[model samples]
Target chain A: MDLERPLPTPITPECRPYWEGAREGKLMITKCRACGKPFMYPRVSCPFCASRDIGWVQASGRGRLFSFEIAHQILNKAFKVKTPVVLAMVELEEGPRLLSNLVGIAPDPKQIRCDMPVEVCFEKLTDEISLPMFRPVGGAR
Target chain B: MSDLARMRELSNAVGIVGVDESDEIGTLPGKSQLTLHVEAITNAARDAGIKVSEIDGVFTAGQHSPATIGEAIGVVPRYVDGTTVGGCSFIIMVGHAMVALYHGLCDVAVVCHGESGRSGVGVSPRRDTALPGQFEFPYGFGGAPTYFGLITTRHMHEYGTTLEQWAQVAVSTRKWAALNPKARNREPLTVKDVLDSRPVVWPFNILNICLVTDAGGAVILTRADRAKDCAKKPVYVRGAGEGSEHVMLTQMRNLTFSEATQRSGAKAFAMAGVKSTDFDHIMLYDAFTSGPPLMLEALGLAKRGEGVHFFAEGRSTPGGKLPINTNGGGLSYTHSGMYGIFPIIEATRQLRGECGARQVPNARMSLVNGMGGMLSAAGTLVLSNEGSR
Candidate 1:
């Protein structure tokens, strides 16, 4: 286990609400008021409509595995995890995709399939930050 | 005039007079990053039979600024472009230079690249507070292989692309590498060898990734009228285009195909008034095994979900119907982090009939596509040996 694992420092002021929501076990994403479209990685403006009239909203935390890769090698020394880390892109039910990890399942290709149903689960990395990860909806179909 | 006609006239106005690499590529601990840049610029200037002071425009990318490179070379260029998108910045610079030259922003433009990828000489520290760091890095998603490998995985899931097909790219590219003495990994490679190689990420063996080496390359461009007085035959710029979709991998419109390549390639083809079938040779940047296939499909050279077959069936090999990556490519050649410049260099040489052993016979026209920042940006150039009108 890498005890020196690096945790995210929320440098962007717009993303502070996201970290705050994660701390509360609530998956948060931004939705544009003008276009009514949701987007990932909260920002001041909407990507779809270029509207600054955007606000944070609680997500369903339900998504499907869009794609994934089982990493046997880690590039960053600060990334502390067991071998064969499952790095994945999850398409949330709210329509925004996220870069996350798949937890509560073995990092094996035979066990994971694209479009598998998943639900977000948070891990408390620090007192202030809880990483929102995903896992098989019902123990790996 | 129509937009396409205007583009054609602008593209034809400029041509590459000289292209060359540094004194030596591959591990050069004795040289700094700036040294590599200066050496490549000097060599290219000499190759064009022009003094370094004669260059009126400068373009470059990487940790160093164009101003810093210009000062080191004692050049006060009138027009300067420091477009640092990623590996493909130099390719886009070619397009930027064409516009600058057509408008008389500068007469002689030189685009330069030099990276100490292997030696760590004067390499800048990566910023961990950027958008990717804030969103993706927290999930242990760092490095190019992890990010790019996902695209291959998604491609496989959607199109039923096989792991063996990806290995075929490595094997076929290595075959070309064996023919070039300058290629770093010239030893024979087989499909089985690629599969047996250690897995860095699922669907990606170590052999599927690009090699890390220290290298630099430069290209000198001037108006078509001035190109005739240069040392070598000018390779005319028939068409050039650049586009970008997103910076973060998660924000990509589609994981299976590169929209960036599609947009840039469409503009290039329109400007050149040429179809995909018009080119005698092609050079698609191969930063990873998946790059060639993905970009091929995006560029319309092959049908959707059928690009991998180009390599799997040996059609892109030395004697294939269409020759691709004749200089071995980033996979087997030296990939110094930013590999865009090397493709431009090789395409120019192939059009000049200067490639000794791997030369494609009677090669007249070629297409070069470069991707920057994990498919975030793309630059395409249609080049020909035939002089501009």
Candidate 2:
């Protein structure tokens, strides 16, 4: 009864390590080895100095929800039933901002506010990947 | 790089020999997007008394791909540029093309644009790219309503600009739309109507957004000496300016005001030797209703926090003075998604006294602005009835 699992969204050579690390339930961010400024969304070059001396480090997976919107409706036809999704951009405690889906909260527009505290939880959608979704520290179930 | 010299050189070099448009577009049915573009192009060339084969350069920007338009227009340009910003892009691209023509890149350049933005041409239900910001769109970010919502929230938080003040801009542009026969939202819109409109995003209602429309516009530019031989009045390209910063609103720093748009305008005004007060009427590209008033503050037409003040007083509306966006803008006018190109078309027509009912009584000089992305890329242009040789 052995069946091969589905292939993950083929990660490129430049971004393989980030994926491999994510499977370990660790979210990683890149920074220039020369300068310590934080970077998001794994890039080939350092945005700060345009330097290629980039390295990845594990994030605390903790952040503040800088800005957010609770969507009561889904825009795309495919995601039509997935209404009430809270899409948020979180400014990590490390000073790099990244966009993520805010889980564990009532997806109501009236309740969300800026500067709310949140922590990351990895959802293992596949054996090769774990998505970094966040939830309010004391959010609606 | 600034296009001030290019604007003057264009005025002294090639001139706009043609002025024309679509048949007052609303929701045109039974017409393909490409068909609409070709119709506008042929109409403009015919109005200019020129043939399609004679056009050496053809440009399409914003949403329309250069390859798609070049194939549709039946003319392969020696030079092609498809810089997607907002509607103001065509105006800036015209400035760049003038510089290229000065270098003998191409001769008769025609700027054309068409899109079924309202119809949503096969865009994915999810975000398009794996760009750094894909997660935001699923939650309904980056739509016209959302982008302006972000700006409006920040503006209110920082400067205490009120929602009524934001509504006033929609109110003022609609007043101008009422006079224009071509304007889609001809019925006058009150500030209350704008405020009462359903909120797509917080602080932004439906009236605050540009309508998704199927429309097209075209303009012809050629040698100044040759322009005099054509059938219509040639509005001189006085000064042109352009600049860019970043694309996504979440990524850009200091979203307080559009520095890039203001800077582009400053360069244009300085090169043209005209202040904001010098222009008789302005033909700024208005994608969302918030764009015009924000531009008023950004371009120094009104002071900071004074953008709302400029509109709330009723002085900025119509008869009080400092008339703007006489085309009803994208909000009330045709919003083909590439809105910048149409302002140039309208400015040329207005300067030529072609605007029948919407004509500004004695419009002499016009300042035009094109805004692309999340106010990331911008272009400002100056056009004058004082045609030069």
Candidate 3:
């Protein structure tokens, strides 16, 4: 198992656009046409109003660090080299939070703070899959 | 009738006549998860002094069907419930059982849970295979510890909750473990010990995480009136309610507190016609050290962001204002993956005056809170001695 690449997530019909967008360097979120509520972890319908009239919108690719943890002991063998991995929850500027990895910075609590500004960075793991990771904006790695 | 009124009508309509566990609480390597369920169910039936055939309703949470359980137990249940959320699934089943008894859907109900969390003998939910797996797994969302670690981290960042406050939870729970002969880890623990423990996930050391043991438990419910005919005194279910917001932790609107717990606790209290202050004992599921404070806030016993303060103040510890988790909790007791059932059993034991050393003095009422699915699902139960109401 390569530490640089973990297992790929199984794509479903509802989330195919999300992966496709990541591959194109665009972070996608669903906006409900009826209620105008936006959400992540893609959906077939608006989670709030159950609106079928949903469209994919490019996210600002900017977010804030809501919370994070430095997994000192890697649970997944695929990320063994990335010990002390920065697993984080990034709340998008558009109003939904999604789980992602924080890169381009030390995986230390002293370096990470809640509400820190972050921008999306895509990691092209395969021809079809690209993981959306976040990094501290203008911060030293 | 309003939902609360309907719940109130069901309140105390059913009583828990029996509660028991599998042959062991921790590390039964040779036993299968199904065997644990059978053992627990059989023990509960024996404890209730009722034949297995009397159970007209069979309910469980996670990975198993009523048809499978009924076939194993050798009875065809008229009603079946398999509501799988996570650890709190069993607690939610109890609430469902009360309604079933009240509505005459079944005369007797058995709620069971069994897991081979440590042994790895049973089927466990694979987050990597779920719909969100595409988003979660690749980035190292391993399981409960990482998921809960994020909540704990955000809570600390928001509430100024310190590491010592988290460690204090482990310290206090260990004191409770010292009194229970069945508890796995009974040694004295200190804040320093917790802080010094090896890290599994950030903000959570080995002591902060629940022990993964293989165990199972079951509880039997019957109509309150029929409970009088049982050999053992019944622990009346005065109130019960369940709620869920989201299964994934990332989607939770608020990271500092659980909305499901607040809703469920409020509904349970309203149905029981009581408040948080009325309880003689409390049992909040302790899957992780961070849970107690968060749950305390959700239950309205403590203010938001003050859960750590509430726990640090020694309010929930032994010889304190409100005795909690007298069975040592999942922190020091057995946590066979889903820890919801043990608290219900402990609450029942406390209400019946059956806990010898760990007994709450003359305990008339007890509150039990069970959580599941990354603090996504919550079930609260308000129970009392038969005479309390």
- Fraction of true contacts retained by every candidate, in order, equals 0.71, 0.10, 0.73
Backbone clashes per model, in order?
0, 9, 0
Highest lDDT: give the candidate number: 1
* Cα RMSD of predicted structure 3: 1.7
B1-389 per-residue lDDT for model 3 (tens digits): 78777777877888999999998878888989999999999999999998888888999987678888999999999999999887888888898999888889999999998888888787655534755567777888867898999999998998888889899888888888899999999999899999999988888899998888989999999998899888799999998879998877877988988999999999899999998889989898999989988999989988887876655435667777788778999999899888999999999989999988888889999999989977899999999886343
Please give the TM-score that candidate 1 achieves against the real structure. Answer: 0.98
Best prediction by DockQ: 1
TM-score of A-chain in each prediction? 0.94, 0.83, 0.91
Candidate 3 positional error at A57, Å: 1.6
Real contacts retained, model 2? 0.10
Compose the digit string of candidate 1's lDDT tens values, residues A55-118. 8889999999999999998888888787788999999999999998998888888889899999
Best candidate, TM-score: 1
